[model samples]
Each structure stands twice: as C-alpha cells, then as structure tokens.
Target: MNKTFKIYAVIFIVVMVILALLEVNKKEVTDWRKNFDTNEKSPFGLFIFDHEAKDLFKNKLKKIDQTPYNYYNTHKKESHNILVVETEVDTESWNKILDQVSNGSDAMLIVSQIPKEVSDSIGYYDSEISFADENVLKLTDKKYKNDFIKLDKFPSGRGFSYIKPQVEILGKTVEKNNSDQANFIKIKFGKGNIYVHCEPLFMTNYYLLKSGNIKYAQDVFSYLDDKETIWFVESNAKVSRFFMRFILSNPALKYAWWVLLGGLVLFVFFNAKRKQRIVPVIEPLKNTSVDFVKSIGNLYLQEGDFHDMMAKKAQYFLNKVRLDFLIDTQNLDDEFAKKLQLKTGKTIEMINEAINLIKKAQDPYAHVMKEDLARMNKLLDEILK
Candidate 1:
C-alpha cells in the first residue's frame, strides 16, 4: 500500500510538470495596441497611412517615432506640418509644440482629452462624453455643411472649444438643443496656425473602413496640404518602460522569466548556505547581589559594629514576616510572635526565641556574638520549615 501511494504521488508531480511546460510553449492570439499609429495593421490600427494615405499625400508624410522633444530639438527651425494623435502631452512637449507652431509651421492636434497647459493657452477645454444616436457629424464649413459622414460612438465627447474672439470655430455638432457643441477649433499662434480637432477616432482603422468615413480623414489632411513634410508623432515614454512592456508582452519570455524567478527562490531556500564566522558565547556578567552583601558584612565586622549588623538582620527578618504573614512589625512584641507562629505553623517557643533575639539586637550597647547569629539563623530555619 505504501509503494502504491508513492508511485501515485510521483505520477501526479510528473503530470503537473508536463502540463506547465506545455502551457509555457502554447501560442497566444495576436494582441495589438489599437493605438492611432500609422504603422500598425490591427483593426484599430492606421495602416492606411503606410499604403494609401502616404501615396495620396505624394509620399511626403514622415512618421516621428521618437519623443516630441527629441524630434523638435533635432529639426529646429525646420518647416513642416506636425500631426500629433495623442490625448495628452507633458508640459515640456506641449511647450515645444507651441514653439514650433509659433515659428510659422502648421500643426493639427487631434485628441479627445486636452492637457491643462494646452487647454489654458488655446482657451479650449474638454466636455462630457458624446453619445450621438445618429452616426453622423455636422460640419461647420459651408462646403461640407450638407455632407454628413458616419462616425462610431466615441467613448468620450470630442468637445474642444475656445472663445470666438481668440480662436476660430471650424467644426461643430448639434447633439443638444439650442447649442452647437464645438468639435474642432483653429487657433492662430504667431505667423502659423494650430488646428485642434477633438475627433481623432475618425482616423482610426475601424472608422476609416466605415462607408464614407475616409472623407473625414481627407478633410483633416486638407488643412495641412501646403506643407511638404507632415510629421506624424506617436505617444512616447521612457526607453526602459518600452523595453519592459516588450518583454512582458511575449508569452514565452514572460513564462521563462517566471521560471527563473521560481528557480531563484528555490536556490535561496535549499542551497544558500554561507559559511559564517563562529560567534563567541558571552557569559552574562555575574550577579553582584552576593558580593554586595559580603562586602557590607565584612565592613561591619571590621568596624566591630555587631549591633548594627544584628539590627540589619533583624530588620530584614521583620520585613519578611510583615510580607508573608501580612502582620505589622512596629512593635515586635508577643502579638507578632503569636501571629508569626500561627501563620508559619511553627511552635510558639521557636517564634518567641527569634523575636527575643531581634529585640536584644536593637540596643546600641549590646555585644552581639557569632553564637547569637547562629542561634538566630537556626530559629529562622525552623520557623520557615
């Protein structure tokens, strides 16, 4: 029976190991970022730029894969149309973009969420999510006013607006009564212009595939047609973060990393034996109670103060009697003797002898001897027993 149980346990462990290896090697379905990148081929990717959009724009569209700061710093004072398709930008990137736009270059910023720096500078802010029952957009331009293009139900409202005195309202929608919510605005920065369009989803692969939705992307490009180069910037982060994400996204590598972590834990548990130096056993310093009492007794004996020694011994004995029997020792008379004898279950003669010796020791003129201390010690031992 014991052999059978051992065989079954080993079989279970072997099966588990096989299953883990199989799981680690299993293939996973393709997972795409679904971002508004011009290079991706996912359902939500903008692969059209790699194929049709670049061709339509005369192959002048350039993809800027680095951070905005790096790209702008490297291409300082260069004239180009910049297209940023992210919802938010850091303060540094935002300032650099503003500087570029102010330097006589056209820029089209398509976003759903607006950063605080840009919102304050452009006088535009984000509104609530827009859920239009109809899949159409009402264009503000008179040329496209009659043209209503199909749009997906955007997760958030493309509501970016500025004061009419400061910026131009180029596009709007009539989703609510008595008000036309602005979805696009054009701001004149310095010698150039910065166009802020809230509906970037219209450029996505899913929306572009919809019937008559490509026209929306076409109109967006129409604003940047004068420039020979159009820089398409993607969302950026630190290099280390990108590398970690790349590693974690691979199933095989992720599993191997987990296995390595498990091996490390086992190594630390089973084989992490380091030779340590021997620690010397330190005996605690000896208690000085006995030495202190001996020193005091020797001093009293050398001074010939036997009476004081006897008084101290008597006081210590009385204190023990007071504590053990809960009796007062202010007057160590017959009452104390009777109490001590009753509490200790000792003979009255023995209790009386101890008490009489204590009383005789109280006189300063009394000559206490070794025989008296011996008798007193014997009397205390008898009473304790």
Candidate 2:
C-alpha cells in the first residue's frame, strides 16, 4: 500500500478497535419489546407456549407460518381452529380468514386490537386501546364473574359500546372502578365461530412462566371446539442466529469482513471505468480528373485515331475562345477567323491556322495526321494566350 492507503488503513483499524471496546463495555439491559417470535427467547416471545400447547390440544397442535387464508385455502376439506397473535394484518387476509371461519374453522384473534374492516363487515365498530396499568380480565358469564386475572401493569385495554345481536359476549376488561368493557366476544359465522380477544400480552412467555397464569390463557381458549388447532407464526425456520453474532463479537473477524467488503468495492470501482479504442489515420482520396484525361489520350494515340483527338482539341479551344473573348466560331470561315483574331488580339496568321484546323476536323471525309493535331494545338495555345 502507498502512504495515503496506509493512513486510511490505520484510521479504519482505530475505528474498529473503538467500536469493539464500546460493544464489550456497554451495560446489559432487559429487552421488553413484544416480538412473539416462535424461536425467540425474549420475555414477550412465544417459545415457551409453543412447546407446551401440544398437551392442551391432545398432541394435535400444528404450528405453521402461513396466514389463516393460505392454510385454510390449501386444506379446504379439513378444518381446524386457528390462533393468530401477529400484529398488523391486511384487510384482504382478515376477510379471507373470516371466510374460512364461515366455511368451518374457529379462529381466535388474540391481538392488541380488532381490525375496523372486520368490525364494519360484522355491522359494528370494536377495537382495543392500550392502557397504563392495573387492568383486570374476566369472563362475562355469571358463574365466572368472580374468577378473573388481575395485572398490576398491562397494555391490553378497550371494548365496544354497541353490541349486535349476532355477537356473544365472552370476556370483559374491568379497570379499578371503571364500568365493564367487552374486550372478548364470539361471532357465529356460518358453521363456525370467531373468537376475538384483545389481551394478547397475557399469552407471552413472561406471563406464561408465572404461577397459574397459563391457566387463564387456557380458560380463554377452552371455548374452541376443534380437536386440533393450527398456530400461525411468521414464515421462517427455527435456525441458529449465532453465526453472524459470533463473527461480530470477535474484533479480528469483524475487521476482516469490513476489509473484504471495501476491497471488493474498490475493485469494482476501478474496473468499471470507461475505456476508448485507438482511432486509425486515414489518407485523403487522390485527384482522378487529370489521370482520367491522360488515360483517354494514351488510348487514342495507341489506336491511331488522330481525327478524334484533333476534334477534341478543336472543341476545347473554341469553347475557351467563346467564354474568354466572346467570339463565335460556329461557321469558322474568314469572317469568324477575323472576329477571333480581333477578340484575342492574336496575329492574322495564327487565327487563320486555327480556323483551318477546326474546319478540317469538322469535315467527316477529311483525313487527319498526328502532325496536323500538334500544329493545331500549338496555334490555338498561342492565339488564346
């Protein structure tokens, strides 16, 4: 490497060393974000519940990553209760899920809130809102009125005011002194029922690990009559995430990775430059007018066609006289020769000789010699000059 490249390398090493030191010395804190990933080990993840749910459904719990619409669409002949705990479902998928419920599949939506399109389709407006703390979850049935789960700090809160006749009240959220709000309900869709519970945080690993907290979730799910239930998670395999984390934790490996990436970028940048080809030198075309006249003159001399050559000379001389001196040589008699001598300021002898050559060339029966052609050219040149 050169001086500039070595300086950049030193700067990069220093930055990487600083980043590694900061990563090693940083304080560890608990991650309370609600992920609910099947493979995640976070407090809010469903890793614990996913393994334990097999016993509740009698070894018939099938975990899948597809949406409710996709699962039910593929397995049209068969039916099973579906559990959806994911956040932010699209309107089309929500409608398709309800269609599957109508066909014959009890779907439990344990989410933070119910979608407005679903509520509007069912002829009511119902959704959940996040509450600060001290929320109580209980069923609406008279006998289970006293049986309730109380949380000192929870986020699930909200219920609908207007209830349609087709809706069956299942559960309620009772705050400290506030009136009861229907947080959970069941709607009879053609051959099946759709259960909507707003308290999804209770089904996480944090709550399930607590003493007797899993029973509350079990009691809420006891309403489903299907022997087997299909749990929908995201479309991802339960694989190890330690390969990248292991590389990033070591300073040497991380530095090598960054250096390799930079080398590849530099290689591409240098190779992608525009290249130009060499332009060749071209000579101009030769003047062919003089060569063409010389070739025709040689051919005429070899053929011994002295009359044709003399005729060409006569035509050229007459045209020159007409253009330069404005003299007419149509008849080429004594009158024309006089006019030519006057216009060209030549002697009468040269003018008379040019006129005799022109008249002899014009006659078809006249025989011409090479000497006659040469004399005619000499006389015309002297006169025209």
Candidate 3:
C-alpha cells in the first residue's frame, strides 16, 4: 500500500507540472459584450464617455446611482440638467422623470429605441433601425448643416418620422435610400425643454476614441444649458476579493484552476474504499463460582488456618438453623438449643452436644485440632438430620 501511494504521488506531481506549463503559455480571448458601465473598460462600455463628460460639464457633473423616481422623491424641491443614457427604463420612473422635467428640470435622453409611453405622449415615431458600414449625420442649424459627419463602420444610426408640430429638429441622418430622417429633436414642456436622440451608441466609448467622430457627441451636448447636470449611468460593477481578481486577471490561472479540480476528483476516485466485512459474533465466558470457592478453601487449608475456618463454619451452621427453623439465634443459650431440638425432633443430649461444639469453634483463641473438628462435624450432622 505504501509503495502504491508513493507511485501515485509522483505521477500526480508530474501531471500537475505538465498542466501548469501548458496553461502558462495559453493566450487570453477578448470579451465583446455590451456592458455600458462607467467602471468597465470594455469596447462597448462607457468608461471613456464618463471620463470625458467631466470636461464638457465641468464641476457641475454628478452621477445618479438610483432610479429617477427615488432621486426626485428624495429631493423634491431641487432640479438639475438631467442626462439619461440608458437602453431600458422603468415605466413609473420614466413618467416621474418626465413630470420632473415639465415642472422645471431640463433633460437629454439618448436612447436607440424610444419608449412607447414617451412616443405616444409627444406624437413622435422613429423608423426601423438601419444597418450600414458607413452613414452621414449632420445638425439642422444652417451654420452646422454643412458640417456633415460620416460615422463609419457600424450599425450606428437610425431615422425618424411623424415628428408632429411645435418640435424643433436638431439633427438628421441620410438613409441608404437617399431619404432624410430626423435623428434628434427637442420639445418645450411647461417651464423646461427636453432633447431626445435616436442613436445612443454614438455617445459610447467606441465613437469617442475615433479622431473626428467625437465632434458629433460634442455637437449633441452643445444644445444643453450650462446648468448643473446629473448623469444617470450604470453602476453595477461590484468590488471583488483580491485573490479572486488575481486568478481571473490571467488566462493561465483560470486553466490551472480546472486542472487542479480534475486532479482532486481523480485522487478521490483512486482512494475510495469498499464497506468492511461483517464483524464476527463472540460468546461470553462461562460461570466458575463453585471452582472459585474451592480454590479459596484449599488456600486456607494449606495455611493451616483451622480456627478461622471453624469460625466461618459455625456462622454458616447458625444461619442455616435460623433460616430452616424460623428461630432467632442472637442468644445461644438454652432457648436456642430447646428450639433446635423441637424443630429437628432430636434428643436433648445431641442438640446440647452440637451447641457446645459451635460455641467452642466460635471462640477466637481456641486451638482447633483435626480430631475436634471431626467430632463437631459428626455431632452437627446427627442434630441437623
């Protein structure tokens, strides 16, 4: 068993070394999911946008980590230039945001798909999103109308229709069919104004990294008033443990984790034991009470302790007489002898002789000879019979 264990240990060590070397040379793959979190530096994340927005809005820029309803409810009397760059919205929160905007606050919402509630309320509709490798976009104002931007290599733009009355068309895109569509619009409600844009991806980290594509994002923000702005951005990236972060930072460590797990599973399989055989039943020892008493009697006889043996014999005889005759033997006077005679129907002479022998045996200092012991046993037999 010891030799087998040593062999398995050596084999396991070799396997682990080989696995570690292979994992160390493995290459990592790129992640291509759209997270849009301010903390994430992925291709579709908003890390670049969140960092650069401070320059545009200055010290007035703050982040909202809660729902619009929660923020508005807590700070009911306060208002700011609100910027919402989100794909999904809670209906109640969106309505509350619109209510806050109408009361006094200005808001700019950049979303690819406008919610049905907002579209219906404003009598605005957008055309189906179109995909292209390159597209042309420009503002409506005459001074910037000639400043056209070609957002290249992406499904990055869309068009609009049913723009309704009393709305200002801020920006537009020329579709592949050579038809123009409204991409950005503004409407005044109560004491404030709202700007809604159709192509929200143009504001992400991808467009900001490009040389001239940043002009479009800047031109869009130029419409907002220079009020203190609160941005509602994603805040879902959680703090993680250092050990776990270290393991996940490298592809090699991730593969080593799998290898170690497989090694543990193999070790458990090889060391598993089957149920042991049923234990055998054992018989208890036999009784030896008579043999033990005989052995003790022989030891006393060998030591010549005749007086002590006679004293014990006298006690047993008295106990037997009391139990058999139902008589008290505390006093061994004439009454006990008379009672023994009556129970045994023996002669008075015989009973008296046995009682005298028992008294002599009970005396501690009496020298009990073999002849005296024989005579006492003979008399006791005759009286008890």
Top candidate, metric TM-score = 2
Q: In candidate 1, how many Å is residue 29 off?
A: 8.0
User: Which runs of model 2 end up more than 4 angstroms from their true locations?
Assistant: 1-4, 24-27, 128-130, 236-385
Q: Given candidate 2, what's the lDDT at residue 46?
A: 84
Q: Which digits, one per residue and each the tens of the lDDT, describe model 1 over residues 129-200?
A: 544444455567787766555654443445754355777887765654325677778888886788877766
Which portions of model 3 miss their true places by more than 4 Å?
1-32, 146-148, 236-271, 274-385
Model 2: per-residue Cα lDDT at residue 29: 67
Q: Where does candidate 1 have its weakest 10-residue lDDT segment? A: 235-244
**TM-score, structure 1 vs. true:** 0.55
- Per-model TM values vs. the true structure: 0.55, 0.59, 0.56
Superior by TM-score: candidate 1 or candidate 2 = 2
Cand. 1 Cα-lDDT: 0.69
| Pairs in steric clash, model 3 | none
Candidate 2, residue 198: CA error in Å? 0.8
Displacement of residue 130 (Cα, Å) in model 1 is: 2.7
TM-score of 2: 0.59
